[model samples]
Each structure stands twice: as C-alpha cells, then as structure tokens.
Target chain A: MTVTMGKALTAALRDAMREDDTVLMFGEDVGPLGGVFRVTDGLAAEFGEDRCFDTPLAESGIVGLAVGMAMNGFRPVVEMQFDAFAYPAFEQIASHVAKMRNRTRGAVGLPMVIRVPYAGGIGGVEHHSDSSEAYYAHTPGLKVVTPSTVADAYSLLREAIADPDPVVFMEPKKLYWAKDEVSLPVRTEPFGRAVVRVPGSDATLLAYGPAVPVALEAASAAAAEGLSLEVVDLRTLVPFDDATVAASVRKTGRCVVVAEASGFAGVSAEIVARVQERCFHSLAAPVLRVAGWDVPFPPPVLEKYQLPGVDRVLDAVDRLQFDDAPDPRFLAVSP
Target chain B: MTTQAEHRMPAVLPGGVPPADALLPSAEPVRFLDDDGGPAPGDAHGRYERPSTELLRRAYDAMVLGRRFDAQATALTKQGRLAVYPSSRGQEAGEIGAVLALRETDWLFPTYRDTMALIARGIDPVEALTLLRGSWHCGYDPMATRTAPQCTPLATHAPHAVGVAYAARRRGEDTVALVLIGDGGTSEGDFHEALNFAAVFHVPVVFLVQNNGFAISVPVSRQTAAPSLAHKGVGYGVRGERVDGNDPLAMLAVLTDAVESARAGGGPVLVEAHTYRVEPHTNADDDGRYRDHDEVAAWKRRDPIARLEAHLRSAGELTDDDVAAAGAAAEAFAADVRKRLSEEPVGDPAELFAHVFATPTPQLREQAAWLAEELAR
Candidate 1:
C-alpha cells in the first residue's frame, strides 16, 4: 500500500508499542496533537496516555528522563520536534544517552530512540530547518540513522528501538510527505548497510536522508545528458557501511558525498575521508562533496541556495574528471 | 481605574491544590540534636519522630566507616592512586543517612561526592574508587547494586532519577529512587525539571539535597536566592523539608520519612540538609582560596561522625567497645582500599571499543584493530 514517510513512522511506533509493553512514546505535542508533522498521529488515541503522552516542553528534561527510564528497563521513544531545537538536549544526548552503557561497563544499556526531524527544504522559517545529524554522528556511542524512503522509515525505526543502545533517528522533514508503495513490516536491509538506489558505471553519488532523493534526481537528470551516475543511500551514518560504499566507489572510479548539513567538518566530510582511504588506489579523481554551505540555516527565501540540490550534486559530479565527459550538465542547470 | 470585579477571575486550575505551607520547607532547618548531641530546643524534636535506636546505631557505625572511606579516597588522590577525589568528609550524615533510608530494591542516583553512600549501599570499596582511579567510568555493576554511576556533571542525573521512579510506578513496583545532589545543583535546569517531572507524574522519588554550603567555591547564597534549597520544591508541587545535615538522627529521620512517604504513593519529596563542606571540592582545589579558614574550623566542630557518636553514647545505643569496633572496621576497610588502589589498573586496550554499543560498528572494529596493530608494534 502507498504510505507517506510520516505515516510509515507512525505505523512503526504503533507496531513497536503494540509488540512491547515497555515501549513508551512521549515528546512535545506528540500526544493529542499527534506531533507537529503528524508522524505520531493516532498513537495517543490508539494507545492510552500511559503508553503515549505529552511532556513539558523541556528538551534536556525529555532526554534525561529517557536515560533514567532506559536504566530502569523501559524503552522510551522521544522526539526532539525539530533539528535546531535538539541543541538544548545535546549535553544529555552526548554526556548521558551516548555514554550511559559504556560508563556502566554494559551493566546499564539505554535502549532509547531520539527521533529528530532534520534537514532544510520545506521553506521553514529558521529553527525548523537544519541538518543536525553530524552532531549525533560525531558522538561515539550513539547509533545515527536517517531514512530517505518510507519503507526504511518503518524498518529502521523498529530496528533502532529494538537494538539495545541509544539511536539518534534523524527523519528528513522535507521527505515526511513523500509517498511510496510498500507493505507494512517491510524489513529492508538492516542498519549499517548502504543500498544502491540506481546503479551505474560512472561516478557514485553517495547520500543519506534528504540528500538521497536529491542524488536520485541528479542521477536521472545526468542520465539524459549521457553521464552514468550511480546513486547510493547511506541508511546508517555512524556504523557507516564502508565496505558497501568503497565497493561502489571502486567500481565507479569516482565519488561525490552529498548531505544537507554543512561540508566543513560535517558527516559528508567524514564520508569523503573514509571513501578515499578505502578506495584510494581505485579512485580516478579526488572524492568530492555536495553539501550545504558552512553557515547558519538561511532564511526561508534563500534556503534553496543553502541546501544541496540536484544541480549542486551534478556540479560535484561534473568535477569528477572523467576521461571523455559530455558538455557540463552543471553549467546548463547552474544558478 | 480597574474595578475589583474586573480584577477577579475564575480559577482555571483543578481543585485539591495543596496548601503552600504543606509543600514549603520548615522555616528553619529541622534538628533533633543540639551542639553537644543532646535533645534540640523547642518543638524541633516534636515535628518528626527520631529514627529508632537500632537504626541510629547502624547510622553511627556507617558514618564512622564512611568518613574513613572518604579520607582514604582523598589520600589516594595525593598518592596518585586516584586521579581525583571529591571528599565527603563532613557530609557523612547525609550520605549514610540517605542510603540507610532506602531498601536494597530501591535505586540510588549518586553524585561524585557520594562515594560514602556507595559504601553504605555495600558496594566494594575498591570498586567504588575505580572511577577516581581512572580504570573505568564506573567500577561496580549498577544493575546489580541498583546504583547509577557516580555522575560528575552537576544536576544531570536528577532527571534520570525521576525517570527511574516514574518507570517503577508504572511497572507497579514499590521502588523509590533517592537522588543525591548538592546545594549548587539546585540552580541547575535539570534539577528543576526533575522536581517538576517527579511531582507532575507523582513519581516515587526523593531528592536529597546535601546543601554542604557550596558547589566548589560558590557558596549556597550565590547558588540560589530561594529561602532554602528545600523551598525550591514547593514551586514544583513537591513536599519539601529541611534537616540539619550534620545531625545523623535528623538526617535519618527526615530522609526515612521522605522515602517511606514516596513509597506509600505520597508523590515525590525534596529534603534539603543544611550542612558544610569542611574539605575542598576536590584534592586539586585549595579550600583556603575559596573561604576563610575560621569558617572551616567552625564547621569542623559540628562534625557528623563525632556528633553521631556523642548522640549514640548519650542514648546508650552505642558503647565504648562498639565505638572502637566501628573504628577498627573502618581502619580495615581503608587499609584494603589503599592496598587495592595502590596497584595500577590493568585494562585491556580492546576494552576501549567494548560497550560503546551492543554491536560494535564497523568503524569501531576497524579503529580497534588499528590500535591493536599499533600496540603490538
């Protein structure tokens, strides 16, 4: 059946809650309001307030409480509401949620999921649009995963909540409304594995979350111009599927890491560094990155320029230094 | 030019709002022991029942041992056996009293200075010092002991305690969590949030604020302008109380009431124990730089261990031989800790990658292998 990414996430929450009585869902406006994006719609009505509820609007308190609940054998699924708003809970996520299991020598494991609606493209005023995955990915103990497809949204979230560790589940806000036809309980590739969305023999366009769709669009657009672009979706960011990514990059002989977050010391930068180290001898040219500019998420009107789009990705692909390349598709679509 | 009728409005809140006096702490710190460990003046002893003689004697013994443990840990820092030690020398009453008030099935969320309480909870002295010894973040099994890792970041563990208590209530477990924080932690947002969450959810948790007068060099006055740290709870709809932190009887009675009240489904309670820090925040700090030496000397006279010993003897709950036995036991424990900590910790280099996640990511595995190769070379 066709389902939006938001609906798929709600179904995942419902299924997980139905399966495990210890699983709880709570966050700002997540109960009766069904969350701002409606990702948690119908959950509070279906499940009692005991299983799903709203909390006082304190981010640190929300995450900190999850740490304690997890310690006491409860699986808490919390929401940060938006990407930028999650900064207030960074200390809790970084110092407590991520380090609890390690600090306790595996005696205490916080099996919790901090769902963050991330990325910019919906013309959100300011704080609503941001790519904050890099912050979570940089932390060692956290498992960071973002779903670009509706089916993965249902599967990855379930797997994340089931895993005996803390996971920072980044939901691309722009793709929440994206639709796809998939069955319920669609168990896709497990986390830490990248999937080749559109295979090609030319350069690889590696992306995750919102960038995956952009990379796919770029690949299709490049195809019309005689350039064969392979699209790879990095399902999980932390356990980065190096083997899968390196294999694709080696076959393609070139790579372009794409992400909505800023390139300066961002997840894209890490991906580029890892790909080069793994496939250095096979690389035909230096691995490039198509990422958001190193600036605060811009105003709504100017977000189109700040966020990585199909043309920016093609621009990076154009720089791959192929032996006999067609006229630059980047120049044709360059703004 | 507003009229009285215009000024009046219908109340939006639900009925059964608790009286402010019921939630607010006592006007003055409660005490059952005077300067010489005799019955306190006025109605102080009438307000709360003194703990049983048996419990008081147990507290005295634990305090004696706890004080010695604190001293040994501080000395370990000087000997390079521990990286640093936050001594709970003068706060033994609150540390031991708080632990004695709870059952083994209940949870204890302690701060860095609450190692004394960890010992009271029967954690091995060597394992308790592992964090300070730089062997691991926590030395003992938290799941087995029902004690959280000793949190260092101020007030960060408060919300965790609230969550644990809330979970216990939901699971129909009569488990209560006692979170130990300092006066300075009351100013933190996490502390306030924890109290608010606990009260709103009616969770079974007791926030025992060891108001040892300072968070490092910052005095209690600098930390809050509230009448008392306990008074901070009333705003969150939590019952608040104050006790003389150095008085073991007062600490035990107040904390026991708070813990039992919570376990009885009376919702969360916040008890602020008025006390002083006779030592510096940590061994690396110089107490002289923060406050006058005379202040420390004055608080030293109100020592928790000495006061408890005097009180127990006056009540005939302790004898000279019992006091000597407690000291002997403390000495033995301190000796064992000293010996255990003297040897350097031998940690597996690969352990650095363990526990980061249930399943180590490929990146972590790769990094661990690289480190292994480097160490082998």
Candidate 2:
C-alpha cells in the first residue's frame, strides 16, 4: 500500500511497541497531541499510556530520563520535538546518553533511540528549521541515521530501535508527507550503508536526509546537459559506508557532498575529508561540498537561499574542476 | 571524646527558650541530638526519634571511615596521585546517612563530592577512585553495585536517578533511588527537571542536597535566593524537608524515612542536609581566597564525628574498644588506599577502545590498532 513517511514512522513505532513490551515512547506533545508533526498520532491511545506518553517540556530531562530508563529494562524512544529543541538536551546527549554505556565498561546497554525532526524546506520559523545532525553525528557512541524515503524511514527506525545502543534517528521534517509504496514489516537496506539512487560516472553527489532528493534532482538535471552524475544516498551519517562511497568515488573520480547544515565542521566536511582519504589517488579533481553557509539560520522567508538545494548542488558540481573529463555538451556548445 | 556538652555551650538554650517555632517546620535545620551527646527534645522537632543504640554505634563507625576516606583522597591529590579530589570531610554525616539508608537493590546516584557515599556503601575505595584517577571511564560497574557513577557534571545525575526509580517502579521492583547533590547544584536546570519529573510521575526517588555552603568558590547565597535549598522542591510539588546535616542520627533518620516512603510509592522527597564543606571544593582550588578561615574553623567546632562520638559515649553505647576498633579500621583503609594509589599507572591502549560501545566499532578498532603501532614505536 502507498504510505507517507509520517504514517510509515507511526506504523514503525506501533510495530516496535507491539513487538517489545519494554519499548517506551515519550516526549513533548507526543501523546495526545501526537507529536508537533503528528508523527506519533494515535500511539498513546492505541498502546497504554505507560507504553506511549507525553513528557514535561524539558528536553534535558527527556534525554536524561531515557538514559536512566535504558539502564533499567526499558528501551526508550524519545522524540526531540524539533531540531533546535534538541539543543537543550545536548549536554545529556553528549555527556551521559552518548557516554553512559561506554563509560560503564559495557555493564549497561542503552537501548535508546532519540528521534530528531531535523532539516529545512518546511517553512519552519527560527529554531524550528535547523539541520542539527552534525552535533549528534560528531559524538561517538551514537549511531546517526537520516532516512529520506518512506520505506527506509519505517525500516531504519525499526533497526535503530532494535539495536542495543543509542541511535539518533534524524527525520527529515519535509519528507514526512512524501508518499511511496511500502509494505508493512518491510525489510530494506540496513543502516550504515549508502546506495546509488541515480547512477552515472562523470561526478558523484553524496548526501543524506533532506539533501538526498536534491542530489537526485541535480543528477537528473545534469543528465539533460550530457553530464553523467551519480547520486549516492548516505542514509546513515556516522559509520558512513566507505565501501559504497569509495567505490562510486573511485569510478567517478570526483565527489560533491550536499548537506543543509552549516558548512564548517559539518557532515559534508567529514564526507569530503573521508572521500579524500579513501579515494585520493582516483580523484580527477578536489572533492567539493554544497552546504548551508556558516551563519545562523536565516529567517524563514530567506531560508531557501541558506538551505542547500538542487541549485547549490549544481553549483558545487560546476566546481568539480574536471577539466580532463569531457565538458557538458551545452557548455561545450556555449563556449 | 569529652562527655561534657561544653562544645556547643554557646548554642545552649538555658532559659528553656524553645526555638521560636518548633512546631512549624522552621527555617532552622532540625536537630534531634545536641552537641553534648544528649537528645534535643524530639517533641518540638519533626517526625524523628533517637535511633537505636546499635544503629547509632554502626553509624559512628561508618562516619569515621568515610571521614578517613576523604582525608586519604585529599592527601592523594596533594601527592599527585589522584587527578583531583573533592573531599566530603565535614559532610560525612549526610554522605554516610544517605548511603546507609538505602536497601541493597535500591540505587544511589552521587556527584563528584560523594566519594564518601560510595565508600560507605561498601564499594571498594580503589574502584570508586577510578574516574578521579583520570581514567576515561567511570571506575566501577554501576549495574553490579546498583549505583550510577559519581557524576562530575553539576546536577546531571539527578534526572538519571529519577529515571531509574521510575523504570524500577514500572518493572514491579520495590526500589527507590537516592540522589546526592550539593547546594550549588540547586541552581542547575537538571536539578529542577529531576525533581519535577519525579513529582509528576510519583516516582520513588529521594533527593539529598548537601548544603555544603559553596560550589567551588561561589557561596550558596550567590547560587539561590529561595528560602532554603529544600524549599526549591516545594515549587515542583515535592515535599521538601531539612535536617541537621552534622547530626548523624538526624541525617540517617530523615533519609531512612524518605527512602522508605518512596519505596512505598509515596512519590519523591527532597531532603536538604544543612551542612558545610570543611575543606576546599577540590584540592586544586584556593578556597582561602573565597572565604574567611574563621568560617571554616566555626564549622569544625561542630564536627560530625566528634559530636556523634560524644553522643554515643554519653549513651554508654560506645566504649574505648569500639573507638579503637573504628580507628584501626580507618587507618587500615587509609593505608591500603595509599599503597594502591602510590603505584604507577599502567597504560593499556586497548582498553581505550574496549568500552566505547558494547562492541568496538570498525572505526575504533582501526584507531586502536593505529595507536598500538604508534606506541610500539
């Protein structure tokens, strides 16, 4: 049946709660309000309040309490409410939730999933529209995943829930309503693996979460101009699938990372650096990145210029400096 | 110890001058025992009794050992053994009282200044000193001891304790979590969140705030404007209580009541132990620059050990034999700790990678191997 990513996510939460009696879900406006995005709709009513519920509007408390709950027998799934809203809990995330299991010498297992509704293009104002994945992805002991498709959203979230460690499930706020054909209990690509969504060889676009669709669009746009571009969707940010990324980079000999977060010290920077490390000899030109400017998120009206999109990807592609590779037919004819 | 109650001669209310409002929960901390080893007329005080002779005797031993543990840890920091040590010297009554009040299954969460609580709870001193030794990981196994690591971050562990207690309740475990924070920690947002969560969920958690007068160099006055640290909980719907932190009997009695009430699903309680930090916040701090030496001297006059010992002696429950035995035990513990800490630290580069996750990720393995190669060179 056709399903939107939001429905798929709700279905995934329902399935995980059904499969495990110990799974507990709670956060700001998650129970009766069904989450600010309605992603947790009908959960508290369907499952008992104990299984799914709302929490006090304290972000640090939500994450810290989840860590303590995980230490006990419960596997807690915490909704971060919004991207910037998760910042209040960043201390707990970086200090305790990220370091608890490791600091305890494996005596405890943090079977916890912190769901962050992240990225932009949703017209969210101020703190609502932020791509804060870099903050979590940089922290060790956390598995960060951002699914771009309805099927992957359902599958990756379940896998994240099933894992015995903490996972930062970054949900693209814009993709919640994007529809696709997905079967329930569907098994898809495991986390930490990248897939080539649109295959070509001239240049490769590496993206995760919200930028995946843009990268695909850039690839299709490049195709009409006779420039073969391959789009590699990095569903998982940390523990990035170097094998897939390196193979594509080796074949294409060029890579452009796309992300909506600030460019400095971001996921895009990490990807570009890693690509250089793994495929340095195969590169025809320097790896490039198309990311949000290193400035505070602009107002909602002007956010379109700040958030990475197909135009920025194309701009970054234009910088690939692939002088050796044949130029696009349109560029050749114009010159 | 002197049998005469001359130590607190200044505080003696000879005119039968009952404290202004003994019936009401006074702004003053409740004291069940006077400085001279005599009862403080429990009729006017809140719900409390002089504990049994045997319990008080045991409590005396534990307090002495805890004091000795603090002294040794402090000396270790001076000796360059521990990276840093936050002593709980004057706050032993609250630390030991908080730990001894717990059942074996109940969890205890502590902050950096709470090494005494861990030692009093029967955790090995060397193991408890792990984090303070500059190791990357918390020294002890939290699961085995049913205790969370002694957190260094201000007020962060409070929420964890509440969470653990809440989870235990859902799992049908008759458990309550005792959390230890300082007066300075009351200013933190986590402190409020933990109490608020506990009160709203009706979780079994007892918050023990050791009002030790200071957080580093900052005084409690600078940290909070509430009537008292305990009163901070009242805003969260938590029943807040205060005890004479220097009085072992009061400390143990109040914490016991709080823990038992929590175990019975009576929800959360915030117990403020009105005490003072006898020493600097840490070995590295220049506490002298922040406070007058006379202030420290005054708190020492009401030393928890001397007063508790005098009280026990007056009751005829403590003898020279008990005193000698306790002294010998503390000395032995201190000696063993010195020996353990004096040893050179060994480097196991592999251990750095071992606990980063349940199983080392591929990236960590690669980094560990690279380190191994560098070390071999």
Question: Using DockQ as the measure, which candidate wins?
Answer: 1
Q: Could you tell me which 10 consecutive residues in candidate 2 chain A have the lowest summed lDDT?
A: A326-335
Write down the TM-score for model 1.
Answer: 0.96
Residue pairs with backbone atoms closer than 3 Å in model 1 (clashes):
none
What lDDT is reached at residue A271 by model 1? 92
**Candidate with best lDDT:** 1
Worst 10 residues of 1 chain A by lDDT: A323-332
After superposing candidate 1 on the true structure, give the runs of residues whose Cα lies further than 4 Å from its correct spot.
A323-335, B1-18
What is candidate 2's lDDT per residue for A176-292, written digit by digit as tens?
999998888787898778888988989999988988888888888899999999989999886678889999999999889988888999988988898999999999887888899
Q: Model 2, B246-288: lDDT tens per residue?
A: 9888888888988998897667888999899989888888998
lDDT to native, each model: 0.89, 0.86
- How many steric overlaps are in each model, in order? 0, 0
How well does chain B match by TM-score in each candidate?
0.94, 0.91
RMSDs, each prediction?
5.0, 7.6
Which candidate leads in TM-score? 1
Tens-digit per-residue lDDT, A224-271, candidate 1: 999899899999997789888999999999999988898999999999
